[model samples]
Target: MSSGMQRYTRRTLAREILLILAGLGWLFPLYLLLLTSLKPDSQIFSAPTDLPTSLDVGNYAEAWSSADLGRALFNSMVITGGSVALLIVVGSLSAYTIARRPGRWSAVFYLLFVVGIIVPSQLGLIPLYSMMRSLGLVGSYVGIILLYGGLWIPMAVFLYTGFIRAMPKDYEEAALIDGATPFRTFWRVIFPQLRSVTATVATLCGILVWNDFFTPLIFLSGTDKVPLPLAIYEFVGSVATRWNLVFAGILVALLPVLILFVVAQRQLMRGFSGGIKS
Candidate 1:
């Protein structure tokens, strides 16, 4: 092999090694969490650093029952699923309109959304809570769904708009010439092209909604309505600073997202790459 090629190969190997080490560094805590969750409570305190000598699945059973984690998981799924669905539909429609029409007022409308992104959600939490209360939606599933959807809109819209704008106009123009109505053209022709961006948006929004604690904590009053994150918070509180149970609950809570990432990782990477290419 040429000297230059040999040097390039060595650099590539070094980079891969560095990346592997970094990935393991990030996963170290999660590995510890998983081990702790499988350990008996007695073993948790006694052999904190050591793996369980005997496998015990009882801790998972205990954790699941101790905090209505099952219900919390269900609630989390509903909220995150609803939020992603709404964001995709509404955000895509809004993006298509902005990209195709570009009316005199389009810039103003887009600017408003851009400004919304800059405004922190915490700044409006108090007023938002009062509004939800007045609407008689406190502790309701609809309430949380709407809040999550609304809060995520700005960023979702921004991504959709950029993706839509990058699409070629010829496709829509040809559909128009072929007697397809505007709505039909958008739905059938252009919308399918948006799959990559939509996937990226869904993955991002799912992660955010799944892990969110503040919204559920503040808006949900009943135990049954709380999502996994807030349920885990309650779990920790009940344990009175028992790190074992806390870590166990956190591991349980993280499992869904980890599974999601593992399943959708390829699609997620492709979507991001496609978006950047466009």
Candidate 2:
């Protein structure tokens, strides 16, 4: 018994050591970013990984003003929020229909949405751009929001469908039996039970939309309403990139998404775990 206990304890210690190493590896880049952002231009290349002797915040202020981050922050927030909201409403409704209905057409539609998940958005970029340009939506907030919605709604629907399929139909049936219409039942009875998956969708979609640079770059070019990523890109010049300011801009851009993940992490886990099993 003593030998077995010692072996188990040794294994646990080794596992913990490995985990700590992995965690440090993951955090090393973040540490470097923060450290680099604090150093002056002269100190950056000389001591890239060294801890900053002083907590200089000038880089942050300069990056913010130089990048015009305030307007970019608002643009990103609105676009991300609007896209997630659109996904939740449309994706949930579509998934509910697919899950509850039993027909060849329903299966076909579900298959199409699954195919959408597998297909890359870049495939149709040219045609999509042309269409948006023709519709005069190329530089508009509503256009970008709608574009993100179209790109990500498939993922949202896929998640919702799986969760809803696993769910017992009792609540929905009960609501319908109580004279509630299908739409009303979904809103009142089913959606409340979908809080976990909703968080998952919101977090996943929000992160994607928030960090996406290519779509906004193409669609929102020559416009003042660029997102955070584009604003950060301003620090990257062809001749000389300002490492300190670039790091500061990147750190600033990351804060909102980091806060979002921290807040919704529990729900994200629950959603990934398939929520309440019926």
Candidate 3:
């Protein structure tokens, strides 16, 4: 027993050290970006990894004005929010149906959607661009929101399916016997129990849509339609390589995801673990 305990202790110590190192490695990029944002432009390139001598917030102010962040933030927020909302409705409903129905055709339908995850979005870029152009939906918020909705649906559906599968059918049956219609049963009873998985879906899909640059770059050429990622790209180009300002813009761009993670991290973790276990 003593030998076994010693071995376990050694293993746990090693694991903790490895995890700490990995955590630091993952945070290095963010640290560098913040460091750059605080440094003077002369010091930015001189020693990129050196700690900033002072916390100068002027870079953030410059980024805000020069990047037209007001419009960009609004566009990104609207698109990301709309896309996540659509995914929650469509993905959850489809997943619930697939879970409760449970037949060969349902399996096939789920397979068809799950298989989409294997197909890289870049592969469909040209066709997607052409489709938007043909439909006269290019450079519009609704078009990009719809595009994100379709692209994000598969993962959300997959998550919701797994989570819904784990749910007790007794509650659903009880609701049915209580004279609650199928739709009402879902909204009133089933959907409320899905808080964890739904939060996970919303956060994951929101972050993806928020960070996406290429889709907007291809479909949205107008300044007003451009999201934060594209706005930052254009700002960098116009600034003639002022990396201090660039880092500031990136930091600002990361704020929403950071805030969301800080607030909903517990829910996100529960969602993923509960989903996988179910």
Question: What's the CA RMSD for each of the models?
Answer: 1.9, 2.0, 1.5
Window of ten residues with lowest summed lDDT in model 1: 269-278
Clashing pairs in 3: none
Ranking by TM-score: 3, 2, 1
Estimate TM-scores for all models.
0.92, 0.94, 0.95
Model 1: per-residue lDDT, tens digit, 1-278? 99999999999999999999999999988888877777765676765568877767776777788988999889998889998999988888887787777887877777887898899898999999999999988888888888888898887777778778787889889999999999999999998998878888899889999999888888984648789899988887787745666777788899889988897888777666655432
lDDT of 3 by residue, 35-95 (tens): 8998877776767788777877999999999999988999999999999999999999999
Ranked by lDDT, the better of candidates 1 and 3 is 3
Supply candidate 1's per-residue lDDT for 263. 79
lDDT of 1 at 94: 84
What clash count does candidate 3 reach?
A: 0
Candidate achieving higher lDDT, 2 or 3: 3
Of the candidates numbered 2 and 3, which has the greater TM-score value?
3
Arranged by lDDT with the best first, the candidates are 3, 2, 1
lDDT of 1: 0.83
lDDT of 2 by residue, 69-154 (tens): 88999999999999999999999999899889979998999889889989999999899999999999999999999999999988
